[model samples]
Target: MEKQSRHIFSKVFTNAVLIIFSLSCIFPLIWMFYSSLKEKRVFNADVVGLPSNPTLKNYKRILENPDYHIFDSMFNSLRTTFLSVLLIILCGFIVGYIIARVQFKLNRVIYFVFLLGMLIPIHSLLVPIYIVFKNAGLTDKWYTLIIPYVAFGLPIAIFLVEGFVKGIPVALEEAAAIDGSSFSRTLFSIILPVTKPILTTIAIIQTFACWNEFSFALVLLSETRLQTVPLAMKQFSGQFSSDYPKIMAAMLLTMSPIIIMYFVFSKQIIKGMVAGAVKG
Candidate 1:
């Protein structure tokens, strides 16, 4: 009876902690949603508090603009994120597999260099990158976004995949090879199948990062028609002031897709994380 009581107490304690943590993450989102229903011109000290009355005017205003190109920017961000993540996953898997499976002299050096890329702030490289892109005629296009996103995403993707790859047994590859399965077949059929969880993690992380990135997007992309959601949201900001409610509405719109994705893949992401961490 005492042991059962202790187990219940422990479970309750853990639940309490998780509830607090979840609330912390969720509160800002709740606030943002509340603000979105407010009038754009109204600024109140109690803005974050519950709204006494709600209006969908802000949402309607944005949606009513036929030539605003909000959906186009959304598609632009989505297309770039999709292509970048696909390339990151493919190349990251290949690189991670080779590094984790094969022995080579330069392996450690190469891995360290990848890590170093993460250490350098993106802002630090913006000027040089802008100049290079300008010279290469890559600025103000989807490729401009795709190229940088892939580069930024690769290091972390490689790291996540490497960790998961370390957990996969070497004997499985050997056994598949002995049965006349080619390396590519063994990789796609055997290797990638086992790494779905980790892949999901990488995909989610890269998608969010690329979607929210604003600094480089602001500097590199000048064509209004080609702007992303992050850049488009800046339309609400003027030289002297900003619209809080409309900004909130825009933010809610921007985050809605990712929030839905999280709920959809929360289980797989959790499972993959646990498996990767425990096995690796």
Candidate 2:
């Protein structure tokens, strides 16, 4: 009876803590969304109070105003994130497979090189990258952002992919070899299908990173036409500094897609991380 009571107490305590943490995590987003519907004056007067008179003016202003160009920036961010993640996944898969399966003496060294990349402070290299791009006349170009996004995204993607690849049984490759499959054929036909979960994990991770990235986008992209969502949000502060409602509305708009994505694929994300952890 004592043990049963102790277990019940523990479970109850754990749940209480979890509920508190979850509320803490979600409160900011809730506040931001609620505050977006309020008048700037109302929000300033009662920052935490429920909106007494909700309005859609903030949304309308942000969406309809040509100066905001929120939709265009969203499109640019989406385009860059998707293309960069695709390249990262493809490169990560190929490199990960080679490191996992190939028996070359340099394989370990190559893998360590990628691991080392994760240790390097990305900010430290920003000046040099800017200089190189400036010299090559590639600044402000879409590919300029895409290239660095892929390069920085590779280390984590490769690490995850390699862990997943190692978990796959070697006998499957041997069987494919015996059946007269070429290496590339074996990789595409036999390996890639099994790697979908971890790939999904990589895609989600890289997508978020590329989407939320500000420093690189700010430094590399100078043209207003090429600005991403993060940069567009910065504009609200510059011109409409006191318009808290509009800024909050813009933030909710910017983060909505990612939030929806997480809700939809939350299971897949958890499964992928667990699978990688077990395999690795």
**Candidate 2's residue-wise lDDT over 10-53, tens digit each?**
99999999999999998999999999999988998999999988
Task: Quote the positional error of residue 84 for candidate 2 in Å.
Answer: 0.8
Please report how far candidate 1 places residue 231 from its true position, in Å.
Answer: 0.7
Q: Please give, for residues 1-280, the per-residue lDDT of candidate 1 as tens digits.
A: 9999999999999999999999999899888988888875453556766666789988888778865567878888888888988999999999988888888999988988888878898889999999999999999887788898899889988887887898888999999999999988998999998988788778878888889889889989999889998998888788987878878887788777778877887888789777666665
TM-score of each: 0.91, 0.93
Task: Evaluate model 2: give its lDDT.
Answer: 0.90
Evaluate all candidate structures by whole-model CA lDDT and list the values in order.
Answer: 0.85, 0.90
Question: What ranges in model 2 sit over 4 Å off?
Answer: 239-241
Clashes (backbone N, CA, C under 3 Å), per candidate, total 0, 0
lDDT minimum window of 10 residues, candidate 2:
235-244
> Measured by TM-score, how close is model 2 to the native structure?
0.93
Among residues 3 or more apart in sequence or in different chains, the pairs in candidate 2 whose N, CA or C atoms overlap within 3 Å are: none
